[model samples]
Target chain A: MRGGDAGFDEFVRERYDQLLRYAIMLTGRRWDAEEIVQEALLRCLRRWRRVPADNAVAYVRKAIYHEFLRVARRKPQVPLDELAEQLDLEDFAPAVVARDHVLVVLQQLPPRQRAAVLARVVLDLSEAQTAVELDCSVGTVKSLTSRGMARIRQLWAAEQAAAPGRRGT
Target chain B: MIAEEQEYATRLREELADVAVRASAGQVDTVLRQVHRRRRDRRNQRIQVFTAMAVVALAVAGAFAVTTAGEHAEPARQVDATTPMAQWPARGELAADKDLVARAEQAWHSYRQPPRGPLKPLFAGVSPNMSANMVVVALIAPESGQVAFVTTPIRVNRPSDPRDRLLVRAVAPVTPEQRGVGFMASRPLPEDEPPIDQNAVGMALTSPAAENGKVYTSTIDSQSEPSWPTTVVGALWPQYEMGAGAWNSELRVQFRGAASTEDYTLVTGVSDDVDLGPVALRRAGAALRAEGPGVRQGDLIITPNGVVGVVAAPDGTVDTRLSELAAHGTVGVAISRVPGRVREVGDHAEFTATGPGDFGEEQRLVLQAWDEPRLALTFAKLAGYEPHWLVARTAGPDAAENVLRLGKPGAAKP
Candidate 1:
């Protein structure tokens, strides 16, 4: 499935939502996640003429994840002033206030471990498939997901104990 | 799947569904527009570069130094350097095949040339590893200085030449020392010990390191010469064990741009090629592609190289998630409510309990001024103790809600 611009654009139209969601999970902030996806799509379009259709989806998915990783790797985050500057750029962000108890805990996990749990347990990707995506061994995926889940449970319990004691993952 | 995993998924689905980020149709439209505009701007910059070079060509200029990656490097075909980057047709994604094989396949397709015309590839099998400073074949668009024939980022690894596969078909496992553990009390060499001399053989992997020093299972053809260093180094973090000590420790697997090795040791198998060849590369690619660029933020990918590494491509993605986490990364997980600012350290910090009668056995302390949420209330005490054993009294009122840690702090995330 080589991707021509038409096909590539079509791909973007279909998966933009899912990609955005994945990016948001990868990056805690929405605008940054959106930016990452857009950049990935652009990279895809740049090579649309050459991208194999079979590989385009994987390519973009890789690009999105990589983009998030790259952004996450950037040194000491922008100061609070810069954060405000970015927040001010959003024209209308009504959902910004809707914070989740689980996401707060999720944010605390090692980025890769967090990604493992999401890709494996939540998304139900096979361990082998998840390993391919994570560029690790089956054992690593097992270890990461296991540790990640345990941490999630601990964090969830902690969050619940602090607040309303809601049952957690 | 385990019951815990099932339970986690159920809880996760419910929570994430309730809070997954979303965007409006307008926002999506804007993204599409902006990204395409950026692509166009990039092409336009290439065109501008060509124009600038042409203008410089007209002006007085000194002879330039020729930069080359290899001693016998060949020059690319020179063009007028006046063409726009967009004019040159972009050949699509490169497949996993080598130059000779691609040529062979191209020749095979000669008679089957698409009904359209003679199948002329602008070029074939551009190495995924090539970049600006070290391009194998330079195709600067006419005069624009824009790279017309950009190299692919994915290396080409074709199937083995059957004869070569027969060379070491009966390969056995490596040793425990190579596995980094069985021999010593610990697998990792003590931090005090000097590092191994990686350049023993002169191979890039054996050398200090390469950009993104990722090791994949590789084999170097053994040399009869006495000067030849052993291809088998200690095992670094590898995709799988070929046996023990087949490769060097993970710290020894050096790559350029790679800060830390992911422990994927590239085994130096006995092979026809002196260094990593098609077979090893194909295996590496397969393994890497299978392992998704080892989860960036959390997406799994397969590549010896990180998708977004410490060094990013010019204008590539720049993630700030981890850095932000590093800033305000922790919290007081085990503590009860804010027991004021208990300034203390070690496995446990004893705070004066004004509320021993007010609170239960468990107690908490929150600190201020840090982004990390990990400032856990670290303390352990017997159940029926009376008040008076308090070491430090947390003085401030709202300061209890701030950031602080009490206990032997566990290693924080990088």
Candidate 2:
């Protein structure tokens, strides 16, 4: 019934869907992503009294990142075949196939490199912000992103060379 | 120019714009409902804690106020009483002494045969005119442990001054073994101090035999860490139930410091065995075999440099010297444990080694397994940077058998 509780309800209603989408992108599984978002929101609510109004979204995002890291550390290895199957290439256009192929190649990189590339490109965060989120220096993030992209390009070229008929793009 | 690269990047981003983010409507509802439930639960917990703290504060305040009023009234009453000095002093001292004796007795009684089910005070004592009172009881279950309690005083007035009368009572279990270890007062360390760097200072549970019940409070020390200590009192039993086993399990207590980073206090037993699921074992074995000297199931390899030791089996898996092996390279030797079985192409294998070798040093070694191509390479030179000496395993197919040098800029050619 308090004014603060009412405000929190409003905040949750507005950002729940967006946060869920972000979590889904990060985790690559709907069930795990939803669980992560729900846990993040609950944690945010517990400390709502101290959270600054301006940075509420940032706090929620940080919580999501922390939860993701916790789960990733516990189960670091993912089955390659399962991950490959999860990438639905049929949804892409001819030009998009090249990009999808690039993403598949990106998946082959180490976990840290893949995380850096996604945080930079897919999430569109600044280099400094991505570095802070990863608890690393900006130089490390830049290096990882560069190396990750180079590997993707090499794999794409190799795939194109091997499959001549599918190289229309 | 770099502009062309940037343009290509922009096009790549736009092409992948349709990556769908999908979750079922039911899933969303479930998550939202869980969030709401947790919020409510946490709010209720906070309210309960605040309420309990408030009650203790009020009781103490009330007791202090009543004691002050009694002191003021005593002076006025003294003038009216024309009684003899001998009678007055003896009565006053006797009453005080009797009260102290009664409290001590109550504390002793509460220690023995603590009540089961809900917690309750076993003994209650109130001062004359009911101005101050005390109750003593055990807090937790007798089997789990014992906790003592003392009540706050009821203040007559002047609550704003932050002074209150207090009635205190103490209770402990009858048997020394049943009684919980008493509280250890600790001073907060500096902000920069590690949370759990020091040895445990508190009491530890002691078990006599494998199946016997555990006794509490075996050891106590000052200047110890905050978390409780658990002593491994017995060896692993052949057959024991989960959670009731006397198995040699490692105990770890984690503490978070003021900086919000967690530090762990770990204790290890001499022998410990943990089951790695089939999938994990298979993956680990494959990763190990791909990177180092290939190992098949049941084959043993003894390294000449005292670094690598592995036993390989026929099932395309290797049992390393240790369950977790630190990464290092040295001129050690490996022998095939499997007598007749041969390592074929495309087979997943694992190699493990143990030793006091520098992780950064580059060294050459030969790998000979039955029926497999002979392997010769310098692992440190091939793996790029120095491998972590504690545990490092990589997963990939076997590269070519020629000299495999590590730390090359590009991928090493098989």
Candidate 3:
């Protein structure tokens, strides 16, 4: 194996699950999340030799976010077909009681809102860092997270009202 | 409300932490396979382009020998190409050398996009053979509704090499002034067009030596809309499927005195060193011409995707003013046959301009500026609208200048 290939392969194996979970949080669908992570890793591989060893995980993480945003920007029809399969099979399964309520609720928000909320709440990025990651103004980040949090809260409340016996925090 | 929001935020993070989704088994191998496939595809594409260029170079060599062999030799009835060189008097330092001009014309016809067009040879000039014999031809492609200038390297007595052929120096929609200039030539601008005698500026055909390496940057006072500047730069066409980045889809042209090889394409085309962004050129829409009092007089570009707009600013900045005018109410495609109407784009529509900052030369700066079509696609994707690639025509010259107004399901034409 080429010197870089060994490192890249090892890196992918070690970080794949962590990256997949982060992608799922952003995309709200396992299929879309996998696609996003795969594309991001492929792009990262192109510059793998240059990525700082200590920061490779962060680099791949940022790449995943950017890839998700790019896919969202394209709004391509091909993925919506894949999305249909994901929705039918996994997202709305009878095991909704087992899935995280927040993950279920995140599907209702727009891509930017979800990204903003994830950056602020889950990744624990400050408003400025979120702005830089999302490529928007800090004020825009603030607005997106605020609106996103509100929607998630509303959805969580409605879901609790609908299925009082389901999982809730 | 604030306390509740913070509580929700905290719980959300906690829930996310509990969420776990693993990659499908052997997913790493799948991605590696895809990576290899993409690399193979890119290599194959480059080989195809190289093969085509090699064919063009070989063709140019044979044509040069045939043209120089006999002056009176009836120009072999040309097939599926621009106008034959026999029609125009060769007018440069190499004017005495008919063979050079003829070879340049042949090379240009070989390299031009949408090759079959009724041609009007505007100017032909040759610089004394440098590292390679350089020849430039400016002409009109009526079938495609564009005026273009192409540069090709001719190897007079050497073996054909694909690297020698430099194609598409400049091709843009013929502006009103060029239309008038073109009309002055034997072929008048197509009869259906309105008369533009007032805008026609007489053409000046200069020697290639005079223009060699001289850069002319047109200055626009930041305060006002520039009057017809010397060089007519327009965002020609965006080739989306060609590659991943907006760079592939976008071609910026300075079709006048600004013609030089120092543009973005020259830099990006030759070198694979510069990494590109993942943004794709999604769509090239129908031709939308903005004309009326106050409309920035420019060319009517006909791209494979569609006739987008006349990017007439000398700086090659798209006049968003036309769209901003339509934002108030009126919206429709200007071309009568293409049926579409947009009521209000509201917050969903916007024309975002990205500039390549401080690139020194205006041409480089111009080429890097994102044009309307790419903007339309980007905006459509970001706004979550199904991007219908059509630019709105300014309803009347009365709408505000420099704003973009697009329709929701349709595009805005004023």
Candidate 4:
């Protein structure tokens, strides 16, 4: 289908959520991730005719990734402080706390390392496939994942110890 | 270590397994509307480009005729010291792009001004790379002596002509003293030194041995570049990668206020822009509101749950604070019950904190204080047998006064 064709809307409707989740991983902010997804969808919609029918998701995902990188490049100021919302430690279950802690640790990784870890562990892609996605060498993928995993382990341990009741428990 | 890493990976996978976000009700309609607007903008830009080319052609032809008649051709336009900056003619490589100028003007009008009235285009630069083509526009309101810089990513629809997508990233206010000069640094260079002279547009060189360490800051007087307008914008292009020897380095430009020549410094990092990922902090909706003007670095706002650090914006205004912080900012607050004590031991200090279960006596943390007020916790290790190490402890002070004292030996409690 051409740009703005009937099939285009259907494709977007079906894959919007998946695209958003991936963007969230890339951007970290829901507002930014949503904006990125919308921007990517528009870009893909414009060139729908060229996108491969067999791999429409991959094409759109690539567009989202590039858009995130583009937005990142344009923003070249000092790093802002991330404000952690007040949370009652006693209010949550152990599972909820564990999930939240891991997610928090993921944010501490650099973009390339985050991407590598997500591809390898989350998506379960082979090293070669991960390299193809990241557009880097397989060796670079290995390096990124290794460094990423190491950082995550260190961060997870620190956060666990820091959490009030979790340490003694 | 391997088993712990695997455990963390397993948890990460489980945490993100069901991550999903539903598209908003009008997402499709919004995108379609944007697509139509983009098409219309491209058509209008083409017309504007043609009209500009014709006008330029006529001016050049007219100037040639005057020169041929044995008379000196008059300068197209001249500005005297008496003329206000807003009335000054637009000048820059991208000043000729009428569509961009119009978009910049529109953004400038809509953005929150800093006591400055109307601003006119001063200078612009387009930094094109494989990833994105970014155009940075500097607009100045001379009477108020304040300048605002707008950066937008342009999409080149056609190979020959570049069109403005008009998705203005941010319009940031630059003090008159800063003259709107900024730097865009690329990733660190490789170990093998490449020739800089061939591909360099501008260069900022600082030695590792310099008192400032990795971060190198310098002020270039706008008065020196008389022909280059008060605001000079330059980029350390992507192709000429800066040496990685200065790990996590920053390039700061000192702006001597245009009106009174007072020194004003802006600190910007030369690294990847970090975004707030989905976490309890962001999910619970921890929003940033400027406490007040002139919130200094390391200033903490104590809350019921934890501490919030105030990031210093170049100007004290809330608008500029949010705008600049949107790019790259760091705010880390750690409140731990584990008491950690640090005492100086020669050049480096040793920290003793409570250790966990199987770990022996005390967790010894060897810390180094960088020139900056920030304490660089070198590493934390278990003292006795089978020593396990924790590297790069970047958390904000848990033991506030002690941590501060570790970095600054004679510092009083905050």
After superposition, the stretches of candidate 1 with alpha carbons farther than 4 Å from their true spots are A75-99, B20-22, B58-414
Could you say which candidate leads in DockQ?
3
Give the interface RMSD of each candidate: 12.3, 13.7, 13.4, 13.1
- Candidate 2 on A1-169: residue-level lDDT in tens? 2334446656766676667655655665444666788888888777777767776776787788788778777876556567555544332111112333444555576657766767777778889988877779999998988887666566666777999786433
Better of 2 and 4 by lDDT: 4
What TM-score does each of the candidates earn? 0.37, 0.34, 0.37, 0.36
The segments of candidate 4 whose C-alpha lies over 4 angstroms from its true place after superposition are A1-6, A73-83, A86-101, A164-169, B1-5, B54-414
Q: Quality of candidate 2's docking, in CAPRI categories?
A: incorrect
What's the TM-score of candidate 3 when only chain A is evaluated?
Answer: 0.75
Docking category of candidate 3? incorrect
- The two-chain DockQ for each candidate, comma-separated, is 0.16, 0.11, 0.17, 0.15
DockQ order, best first, reads 3, 1, 4, 2
| Model 3, residue B394: C-alpha shift (Å) | 56
Chain A superposition TM-score, candidate 1? 0.79
Q: What share of the true interface contacts does candidate 1 keep?
A: 0.38
Error of 3 at B192 (Å): 64
lDDT of 4 by residue, B107-171 (tens): 66665544356656665655432222346566666656655555553332222123544333323
